[model samples]
Target: MMNMAQARPIAPNSPSQKQKLPAPRRGLHLSPHMVDVAVQVAVVAALAGIWEFGARFGALNPFLLPPLSVVLGRIWEDLIAGTVPVDLGLTLYRALLGFAIGAVIGIPAGILMARSNVVRWFLDPLVSIGFPMPKIAFLPIFILWFDIYDTSKIIMVAFSCFFPIVAATYAGCSSLDKWPIWSARSFGAGERELLWEVYLPMAMPQILTGLQVALPVGMITTIVTEMLMGGRGVGGAMIMAGRFADSVGVFAGIVQIIILGFVVVKSVEMIRRRILIWHPESRR
Candidate 1:
């Protein structure tokens, strides 16, 4: 028979029992991502403050670097006047359409080049020569062949975007581990099955990287074409402002461009994260 003290259970709320349990997490705990975002926002806010104060205090020339408030006011005015929507729409349409065309053609061509010696032999020289050349120089030829409207601009953007996608895709597919291919072949996988199931999934990261590079190039080409063509886009608005010596309007257009680029780049990054959810990088 055990002694009464030895057999008895402790009280539920005893101090010793409380000490054995884990302490509740205390204070506000910020995630690394939240901290990073806060830092970025703070830096941008600081820069904007400097811009506003510097212009107001005469440290910066108002003509050259307008006050942040003035620029925001100008943008608001344009937004209310309804010109911004039309310009933004046209620019986005041309850039996105051109990028789509480039990707559709470039991805297949790259896969073929990687798979077939004949295709590689034919395209390698063209890619090598064309990649180094300033694609913008071909604008004159494009202009002569097509009109100076959206057609030429879209084609020019597509032309600029093609090389990066092809190079990235080819490299990704060619450098894949041979062991997987061998195993797939051993299991009686057809060429189409191997490509779809193995090659594309493995190479998707590189393909997405290529697309990220190409989108900026496409946007730049679109803007330059719009500027040269003098049409209804942010670039065209900037050029018009320059001709009329409306510095405020020019600055407003620049702000629009910056916002547009930021939105687009962030959107693409989000898409890449979604598409690459199974990738190691996405886990990080």
Candidate 2:
């Protein structure tokens, strides 16, 4: 029972008594994804504006470089007529099919190479020599063997995609630490269990990276084969446009290819992020 004069008043700024400022008002915050989108949009818009201005002012040659509006109009007409969609579907199918084939073959071969001395010895020399050879140089032989058709083109794409995937997957598999294998084996895990639960998961990130590397190669191979073989795709359209000197058609094909490549790469990145959600780097 202290008297009034002896009682100490509460200090407003004392540690436990202090008031919280409302988290410094984090208003109008832009996340990293927002920033990336904004930057990409700005860059693309700026480039398009420059191209349009140059074309309109005759600073750029209309024959080689059609105006953006003309290109867009051609693309719109093709889209409305449904020609572009068919060609797009064919191109996408070939690229994806080839990529799937490449991945199926490459991942297993790479894993085998990493795990088995016999496989590594048998494959090492061939992989070393073939990887550096320009894959496009083999196109004529493939065309002759498979007959200037979808088969040849798809095989070309697969051939172009395989080496990088194999290399990356092998590297990933070989880099794995041994402690996990020992632990799993000590716990009576079989070879299949170790591979499925430990090795594959550990190698997945690099395998996905290999797929990323392979995908663009597949797309490029498809387009090149279409051009060479005079077939149904944007590349074929470009070749025909070149013969007729239709700048608008050629530019439209170019624009379509740009859009396609961007979409494919972004989709792959999205998938990679989704699959890597368990990784600490992906959490950031």
Candidates' TM-scores? 0.93, 0.93
TM-score of 1: 0.93
Q: lDDT of each model, Cα atoms only?
A: 0.93, 0.91
Scanning candidate 1 in windows of ten residues, the lowest lDDT window is 16-25
Model 1 clashing-pair count: 0
Candidate 2 yields a Cα-based lDDT of 0.91
For every model shown, the clashing-pair count is 0, 0
**Candidate 1, position 5, lDDT:** 98
What's the alpha carbon RMSD for model 1?
2.5
The TM-score that candidate 2 achieves is 0.93
**Clashing residue pairs found in predicted model 1:** none
